[model samples]
Target: MTDLLRLDHVTKLFPVGGFFSRRSMKAVDDVNFALSADKPEIFAIVGESGSGKSTLAKMMLGNEVPSSGQLSFDGTDVAAIRGRAAREAFMAKVQPVFQNPFEAFNPLTKLDEYLFATAHRFLGASNRGAREAAADAALQRVGLSLSEVRGRYSHELSGGQLQRIAVARALIPNPKLIVADEPVSMVDASLRMSIVNLFRELRDELKVSIIYITHDLATAYYISDRVIIMQKGKVIESGDARTVLEHPTQPYSIALKGAVLPPDPAAASAIIRQRQVVAG
Candidate 1:
C-alpha cells in the first residue's frame, strides 16, 4: 500500500535575534514518520510545550514550510503544492481541528455557517438544500445535527459542543486525515472522553486517519494505536502506544509518564515506584 503521508528528515528553522547576530533555532529537527494510505488509525504525538509537535503539525498542514528535507502526502511533495486550487485539493484530504473550541469560530456568527461553508466549499454543495443536507450528515457523525445549531452562536454552545461542531465541520470535507492539536484540553473534564471517543469512531467507522497531538498521556494511551514522544524538538521514544507508555525507556518519556497522576489513590504509590524504577 502507498503511504498516506511521509515526513523524511524534516526540519524547520526560524531566524532569531537582530540581523547582526542572527542565528537559526531549530524548532523541529529531522522528524520522520509515515501513515499508510490503505490503513486508517489514530497516531499520537505526545509532548509538552515547545516540543515541536505543533510546528510539525503546521509543516504537515502546509501552513509553514520546512527548511530542509521532504514532506509528502499520498506520494506528492507538499512543497510542490501551490496555487489556490492545489492548496484546496490538498486540504480536501487533510483537515485540522484546533484547541480552544470557543475561539475557533466568530462569536456572532451562526454555528451552522461554518458547517455549511465547509460543505459548500469542499463537497461542492451547489445549492442551499444540498449544503444543509451535507452539513446535517456531517454533524450526525459527531452526534449533532444542524437543527440543534442552526441559528446558534459560538457563545451559545458549551466548549465540548463547539468542539464537536468543529470536528463535524472537518468531516464535511470527508478528509482522509485530521490533525487535531490538543483537541480535548479545553473541554470540560466530564466531556473530554466523549470527544476522544468520537475520534475513535471516526477512525473505526469513517475510516479516517487522525494525527492526535497532545500532552496528556492518559488520553493518548486510551485512544492511540501508535505513539511518538518528543522533547525539545526531537523524537525520544516511539512504539505501540500501550507498550511505550507502560514501559517508557527514555528519561524524558519516563518523566512524562511519572507526571500522570493515577486516578486511584491506592495505585498511586505503586505507579510512582514503578516510574522511579523506570527513570533510574
Candidate 2:
C-alpha cells in the first residue's frame, strides 16, 4: 500500500485586494489526506459551496499550485513536476471529471472524437483501429459504447450519457486516481444514483481510486469508503464514511446528518406533514 497522494499542511491562498492592497484569502487551509496506490477506494470530500473542496480538487489536479506545504503524488512533489512530458505523465495517472458534462464537451465536436483523442493522447493508441478499440473498451466499462456515441454531438445525448462519456474518457487513460468534482450535480435526479454508483464500479472493477467532491451527503454516504467534511476551507471531521456520517461528532456534521432526507417515502411524507403542522 504505497502512498498515492500526500498533503503535508497544504494551503492555498488567492489574492483578494488590488495589487496595492496585497490582501490574500485562504482557499484551502492546512489540509492533509492520503490514498494508497494499491487499495483503491471512493474518498468523498463533502461540503457546501465556498467550503473550498473544489479548490482542493483543483490543487490536486495541478491546475492550481499551493501557497505553502507539500503536495505530492506517488512520492513526487506535484508543484515540482516540470516539463510537458512530466506533466503529461502525471495527467495519465490522474484525471478529472467536472461538475457539468456539457461544459466539459464541445457542442460542435463529435462525441467519439473526444474518446478517441483521449485514447491517443494518454494511451498512445496512434492508429485508428487501436484508438477505436481503446475508446470502445473504455466506454463499455461505463455502460456505454462507441457505436452509441459516435458522430453524435454533446446536445444529442442526455446529461447522464454525457457524464458517462466523460467518465469513459477519464478511464481511457487507465488512471489510478480520478478527481471528480461534483460529477453528478448537473445530472438529472433519476440518473444521479447511476453516476454515483458508477464510481463504486470503477473502484471495484477498474481498481481506480476516486476523489468524489460534492455537497450531497446522501450520495456521499452511499458511495464513499472514507470521507472528509470541509467547512470554510478547513476539515471539520474525517473518518470512515459510515462511522462519521452516521455518528457525527462535530456540530456541523450532526446538523448535516439531520438534513438528510429519509429513504422511505412514507417516512419522508410523515416528516413533511410534521413540518407542515409546525408551520401551521
Candidate 3:
C-alpha cells in the first residue's frame, strides 16, 4: 500500500558562522520513513538534545522544508503544497501538540476560544450552537468538556488540564495525523501516564496516526508501536518498539537502554552488571 506519509532521503542543512567563514550543519541527514494510510499507530523518534529529531518533526509538519529529498503526504509532496486553500487543507489533516501546554495558549484569553476557533475553522461550525457542540464533542474525547474550561484562562488550569485541552483542540479538526513533541514531559509525573494512554486511545479508537517525538524512552516503550533511535542527525536503529528497546543492536541504543535504571535497586544493579558484560 502507498504510504500516508513518506520521507525519501530527506536532509535539512542550516548555515552557521559569519558570512566569511560560513559552514553548513546538517540538522537532518538522509532520513527515510513511511506511515501507512490504513494503519494508525504511534511512531516514536527518540534521541537526546541536538539529535535532529525536532528537525524531522518540523519537516513532517511542513513547518520547514528539506534541503534535499521529498516529504509527501497521501502521495502529495509537502513542499508542493502552496496557497491558502492548499495549506488549510493540509492543516486539516495534520495537527500538532507542543511540549509546553502553557505556551500553547494565551494567559489572558479564555481557553474555550482556541477550541471554538478550531471547530469553526476546520470543522465548519459557523454558528454559536454548532461551534459549541463541536468544541464540546472534541473536548470529551480528551476527557474534558467546554463547560469545565468555558471561561477559564490558561493560568487557572493545571499543566495536565492544559495539555488535555491542547489535545482536545487538535482533535477539533479530526486530523488524520498528530505530531506531538515531548507532549507529556511538562505534565506532573502522576499524570504523565494518563496523557500517554490518551495517545494510545487516539490511535486505537480514532485511527489517528501519531508521530510521538520524545527523549523519554520509558513512555516511548509504553506507547509506541515502532521506534526510531537517532544520533547526530541520522537514524541509528529502527524497528518494533519492544524488540528494538529490549535488544538494541546499536551501541548508542544499548547505552540508552542501560541509562534507564529500573525502579528497584536490585534489578537496576542486575541490569548494570548485564550491560557491563555486554560492553566487555
Which one wins on lDDT?
1
Cα deviation at 10, candidate 3, in Å, is 0.6
Q: Which stretches of candidate 3 lie over 4 Å from their true place?
A: 267-280
lDDT of 1 by residue, 1-280 (tens): 3999999999999899998999989999899999999889999999999999999999889899999999999899998897998899999999999999998899888988888888888988999999999999999899998899999999988999999999999999889999999999999998999999999999999999999999999999999999999988899898899999999999999888977888988788887788688889
Model 3: per-residue Cα lDDT over 1-280, one tens digit each? 4698999999999999998999999999999999999889899999999999999999888999999999999889999999988898899999999999999898989999998888888878889999999889988999987889999999999999999999989888889999999999999988988899999999999999999999989989999999999998999999999999989999999899888887899988998898689899
> Model 1 RMSD to the real structure?
2.7
TM-score winner between candidates 1 and 2: 1
- CA shift at 19, candidate 1, in angstroms? 2.9
Question: Candidate 1 lDDT (Cα, whole model)?
Answer: 0.93
Residue-level lDDT of model 2, residues 92-184, one tens digit each, is 999999999999998989999998888889888899999999999999999998889889999999999999999999999899999999999
Candidate 3 lands at a TM-score of: 0.95
Q: List the residue pairs that clash in candidate 3.
A: none
The Cα RMSD of model 3 versus the native structure comes to 2.4
Please identify model 1 stretches exceeding 4 Å from their true place.
266-280
Instruction: Give the lDDT of residue 192 in candidate 3.
Output: 88
Clashes of 3: 0
